[model samples]
Target: MRAFKGFRKDLTCLGFQFREDKINRTEEANCVKNGFHCAENPLDCFHYYSDWRNSVYYEVDAGGDLDEDAVDSKISCTEMRLIRRLSLEQMLFEAAVYMVEHPKRQWNYGVKKETGTACNGYGVVRGKNPRAAGEKGDFLLILKEEQNSPEIEEIALINIDGKRWHPHKFYDAYGK
Candidate 1:
């Protein structure tokens, strides 16, 4: 069995955006059939990873009435998604550091949060909303050589989301 390496906690927040060049026809079809208008060119589909190592530690030193009815709950998952996106971007920045240090490596590897882990099936909380927004989750991932690279003959992405392991390639628009 190949060794599965874990991603740095700091790079957990690399926001994942669907490659804009690729259009998911199935998603588009569903939206049209349901009469639900979605943001055109929706690219926020991939699961984002974050780097938790650089996260600022906040010490909870005070305790107050934590009643659910006391505070007006107006948080939405959309806002949470925005925050998560930003964290993921920051994590990507941290990943650059690693890539620069390890020039010989072909790709960065890391794990993403699994859906069946904890609350809401999310992994760990990478950030928080001041007004009680959605919670963030964590997972694992690592950068590996691109499958079928000239330097490294064949590489594959073992997708855990599915039952069987399959090989994937970095495809651009027009299936390049």
Candidate 2:
């Protein structure tokens, strides 16, 4: 059996808009002024994946001790389909509205070191409103937690590549 690796935290990506004039302000302050900061440096937003699916062609390479003639005999190809995941775009629009309506709204990551483990997550907050295509007014904010930190109390495994594995088990048997 392979050695068991503990839970790996998700890579957090934040997306938000920024103003042309206020680009010099600190990210935390901008997030706070725009009502995206839930508390302090932690952004007050959620990242969601879109349901739209996209397809792409993938090539596989069989690396082994094969002769030159044998290696050129066959072709390996596959199709991979992925959902158009939502990260910052939607969050920016929503956060902008949220800040407008609730200027004092506190958006903060709820994870704490005292919670017995390290909680990893990604978030995006809007720093400004949207403008014309060529105009630069909106901002895309991103935040990422460290990988392989501590374990959270309740962990939900995400099926990113279409294969499902036991959350608590070593996946050495996969792709066999």
Tens-place lDDT digits, model 2, residues 1-176 = 00000011231113433222221122222221221222111122221222112211111121212121121112111211111222334333333343344443443342222111111221132222211111122222222222343211122212222234222222110111
Best by lDDT: 2
Q: How far is candidate 1 from the true structure (C-alpha RMSD, Å)?
A: 20.8
lDDT of 1 by residue, 119-150 (tens): 22112111111001112332212223333431
Candidate 2, superposed: residue stretches over 4 Å from native: 1-88, 110-139, 142-176
- lDDT for model 2 comes to 0.22
Kindly report which residue stretches of model 1 are placed more than 4 angstroms away from their true locations once superposed: 1-54, 57-89, 105-136, 146-176
Rate residue 131 of model 1 by lDDT: 9
lDDT of each: 0.21, 0.22
